[model samples]
Target: MTLNVLFAARPERWESYEPILKSEFARQGLDVALSTDHPPETVDYIIYAPNGPVQDFTAYTRCKAVMNLWAGVEQIVGNETLTQPLTRMVEEGLTGGMAEWVTGHTLRYHLEMDLDLARKPGDWSQHNPPLARDRPVTILGLGQLGQAAGQMLAGIGFPVTGWSRTQKDIEGITCLSGDEGLIEALKTAQVLVLLLPDTPATTNIINPESLALLPKGAVILNPGRGPLIDDDALLAALDLGQVAHATLDVFRTEPLPEDHPYWHHPKVTVTPHIAAETRPATAARVVAENIRRGEAGEPFLYLVDRDQGY
Candidate 1:
């Protein structure tokens, strides 16, 4: 049977994803009628992006699942019309990219790289950095991306601790959860990385009260959601020498307003939401695999939990 797959992202994305999706479907040996203009009622599946034109899923009566093209589903997870099974992208490329970014930043903090880079041209200021084992690194999320980064950091000798809303048991990393675990995790976080998703519970999670738990002069790296850290709280922390520096990528507002304090903060590094992006080549294969699973009566991978909102 041929499946009618609707590509529901922006018009420009159709051009980029069409051939890739087609190639993947052919490789999977599936007959798929993939297009941007398929009749809504006939669409057996939808390749979706939150920025897409398809807001009302009510029209797609036959759509068995909504396969998100991006890793984040926060933008579309609450759509009342979207009652179908929703799956977020979980591809190797994204995981690998996140691991690299986290590891690079973690090492930068561990080595105090900025101190050496900012030294005076003629002044020979001698500074010594500690080994990875001496530095306690904490990750806020223990999901796929977080676990991958944690494993990489642990492999390199960093004492890695992972925290989540619920308990996890990943080998080679200390995993913590719940309120008490949060405090314990923060107390030893000489370097902290935020990889949690954007949700009500996660917004402003790094507030003043939570920030106070970290060891003095703790370094923060946020490749996760922008609201994960409270801007004013982080600024205050930096000013008081509570936090040494912060590297923020995602933000509440895109293009990070010109007047945003994070842009001007001396100790803060603002990266323009470029920590990681979905690559069409690898992402296409993941989408194809999920579609194949749906057809074969197997469980979908990375299905989002509506109640948890991740």
Candidate 2:
């Protein structure tokens, strides 16, 4: 029997993803009829995006699973109508992109490159940077992206510590978990990276109390969710010189609001949320593989825990 797969995302995304998904389905040896328009009741699976047209999932009674196009699922997890098993996108492209971005920014901070780049003419003051081995980098979150970033940093000799809500034991990383572990992780972070998901428990996790844990003049890099850090607390920290600089990619409001304080703050570097994006080729394989898993009765990969809200 041919499985009906609905591509429920933006029109532009349909054009980009249709052929890749079709090719991937063929490569996986699955008889999938992929389309942008399929009767909700007939859809065996939904390739979903939060901004997509399919909001109410009550009609999609046959949908065995929802394969998300993006890595984050905060927007879709709360939909009361969505009862199907949902899987977040986890592919080589997304992971690689995130790792590379994190590495680039981490290196920038470690090397103190910005000072040289922005130096005034004839102001040649010599400033030498310590090697990566001397830098203690802490990452909040030990998921695929975080782990990959940690591994990359570790490879370059940075002493990397990773903290998650749950314990993880990845090689080359000092993995910490629980409340005590968070405090310890913050204490050691000369440079800190945020990669945790957006959940109630995680929102504003990097507030005043957490900021006070870091050593004076610590650098912060946030490519995770915007709400993870309390903006007010971070601003206060910056004013107090507790945190020397912050490079923020994701934000509570996208385009970061023209009048946002982060934009005017001299200590903050805001990059339009370009840290990572789902690559069509690799993401298609992930979607197709999950569909194949659903068909074969195997457990899905990257399935979201509804209660945890990731």
Candidate 3:
């Protein structure tokens, strides 16, 4: 029996994903009828994006699973109508991209690169940066992306500490969990990276109280969800030198409003959300593999725990 797969993302995405998905399906040895307009009831699986048109999942009675193209599922996880098993993307491309971006920003803080970059032509002041071994870096959220970034940092000689909702046991990382562990993680974090998901427990996890725990003048890098940090608290922390600088890549409002205070804050560096993106070439294989798993009756990989909301 041929499986009907629906490509239910934006129109432009269809142009990029169609040929790759078709080729991937063939490579996976699956007979699939792939289309943007398959009848919802006929769809055996859906390659989905939250911004896509297929919001109403009530009609997709036969959808075995919803394969999300993006890593973060906060946008679609709450939809009451979506009852199918859902899997979040966790491929190499997305993980590698995130690791690279996180490492780059981390190194920038470790070396105080910005001061030199902004130096006037004649202003020659010497500053010596400590070796990576002396820098203590803390990463919040020990999921795939967090683990990858932490491992990369640890490999480069930084003492890496990771905090998650539950205790983790990754080699080479000082793993901590729960409220007391969070305090310990923040205390020595000269460079704190936030990679946690947007959940009720994590929202504003970086408020004034948490910010106060950091070593004074610590640098913060947020490539995770915007809601993870409290904007007012962060701004206050910046003003008081509780935090030396912050490099934010994600925000509650994308294309962060022109009038937002972060735009004019001297200590803030805001990059349009480009930290990690789902690469079509690698992401297609993940989607294909999951569909293959569904057909084979094997448990799907990266299945989202609806209750935990990741």
Candidate 4:
């Protein structure tokens, strides 16, 4: 039997992924009908991106699942018409890229090497930096990216503490969870890193209370979702000298407006969402594998749970 699949993202991606996607499906020896659009009556599976133009899924009676191309599903989970199973992308390339970015930035802050590069000519100043052991790093949201980052930081002799919504015991990590645990974990950390997904429980999670738990002049790094931190609270913390500086990657708004305060803040570093991205080659392989499974009567991988909202 042939499974009819419709891809909802743009043709630009199809043009880029057609070769490898088709080749991989061929290797699996599955009979499938693959196209950007045929007819909703024939669509058995949908390769989706939240930003895609498939708002109405009431016509998709045959679709078994909605496979997302990206890791985040916040944009589409609440659609009442989307009754089929939804799955988020969880591929090798994304995880690896996230790990590398987190490690690179952590090391940069740990060594305080940026100060020397920012110095003017002949304005050399002798400064002795503290050892890695002296830097207590706290990682918020001990999920995939956070766990990987925490482990890497710990390997370099920095004391790593990780916090999540639920308790976990990771080797080489001082793991904590729950509301009370979050405060205690923050108190011990000199550098705080945010890597939580955007959800109701996570939105504006980094408020004044949590910021106050950290030691004075603490540094913050956020490469995760922008909504994870309370913007007003973070700004206030920076003003009071509780937070020395903040390095933010993702933001609530993309292509952040020129008039935004974050753009002109002297203590904040805004990177235009370049932390990590899913490579086309690897991501295409992951999509193909799921399509192969759907044909072979096997369960899909990285299926998203709408209840969890991730």
Whole-structure CA lDDT of model 1: 0.93
Q: How accurate is candidate 2 locally (lDDT)?
A: 0.95
lDDT of 2 by residue, 73-180 (tens): 999999999889999999999999999999999999989999999999999798989989999999999999999999999999999999999999999999999999
Taken over the whole model, the C-alpha lDDT of each candidate is: 0.93, 0.95, 0.96, 0.85
Is candidate 2 or 4 superior in lDDT?
2
Q: Please, what are the lDDT tens digits per residue for candidate 3 over residues 24-131?
A: 999999999999999888999999999999898999999999999999999999999999999999999999999999999999989988889989989989999999
Off by over 4 Å in 4: none
TM-score for each candidate, following the candidate numbering: 0.97, 0.98, 0.99, 0.94
Name the best candidate (by lDDT).
3
Model 3 poorest ten-residue lDDT run: 109-118
Candidate 4 per-residue lDDT, tens place, 1-310, comes to 8878787887677787667667776777766678887699889889888777788999999898898888778888888899998888877778778877877777777778689879899987877879989989999988777888888888888899999999999988999999899988999878899988899999988998888889998989999899988999999999899998898998898888898888899888888888877677788778878877876789988877788887
**Candidate order, TM-score descending:** 3, 2, 1, 4
lDDT of 2 at 43: 91
Q: In each prediction, how many residue pairs overlap at the backbone (N, C-alpha, C within less than 3 A)?
A: 0, 0, 0, 0
Point out where model 3 deviates above 4 Å: none
Q: Give per-model CA RMSD.
A: 1.1, 0.9, 0.8, 1.7
